[model samples]
Target: MGKTTRYRFREYHVTAVADPMALPIFEAVCVTGEERNCAAASGELHAPEELTRWIAGHCAQTGHQSYEQTTRTIVRAEPGAWQ
Candidate 1:
């Protein structure tokens, strides 16, 4: 059998929805797991609050309920920070 991988929910960003004028818009976020060579996975949720709920749901379904949220930091550093 092949090895299994686990991914943790990172962050979510509001994208679009069926109606552009809707109060709550759909969101898309990238999730990364233990598989180093694997690419990031994306999931969509109807609302902002639903994003976190969906992530927890997925973790429970995948037998990874112990996945806890690590440090979450948003960077606004200068462009040269990448150097």
Candidate 2:
């Protein structure tokens, strides 16, 4: 089993997933309007607040403003035996 935290910025879709397969175990700030979006990873799991801060930095890097988290979903990107 795994947990995924998805957040919506003004022009970004940030998601941090607790999956071993993910580099550093998390990914963040996928720019919504670009065909070649840059995704960043973290070495460890972060709280939603931390992830939001990361998202803000990512947005600020591009001179964009990030709003609040629009949604949070616990998705099972991988299949396995779990209760």
Candidate 3:
């Protein structure tokens, strides 16, 4: 039997959220499989559009496929987080 190549993903948290005004302070939403080893509070808040573009650019540069699919997995403004 041959060894399996496990798919590893990394999560990068940006200073954003579903409802930034919900809490006393705006907290970032955690996105998985984007930036590599980025600190939770490393950068400023990025809107949904900006975030998706950022991911696509990163993936294209790194020769990673499925960036488009990953972009569709983000949460919407409404409830039921599965989109």
Q: Best TM-score goes to which candidate?
A: 2
lDDT per model vs. reference: 0.43, 0.49, 0.40
| CA RMSD (A), model 1 | 19.2
Residue 35 displacement in candidate 2 (angstroms): 3.2
Better of 1 and 2 by TM-score: 2
- For every candidate in turn, the CA RMSD to the true structure comes to 19.2, 17.6, 17.2
Q: Is candidate 1 or candidate 3 better by lDDT?
A: 1
Q: Give the per-residue lDDT of model 1 (tens digit) for 30-78.
A: 3445663222222444455766775566665654433333322233323
Q: On residues 1-83, what C-alpha lDDT tens digit does candidate 2 reach at each position?
A: 69999996554334445555433323354544455534443224435667666777767776544233333335444444433
In order of listing, the candidates' clash counts read 0, 0, 1
Name model 2 segments beyond 4 Å from true: 1-26, 64-83
TM-score, predicted candidate 2 vs. hidden true structure: 0.35
Ranking by lDDT: 2, 1, 3
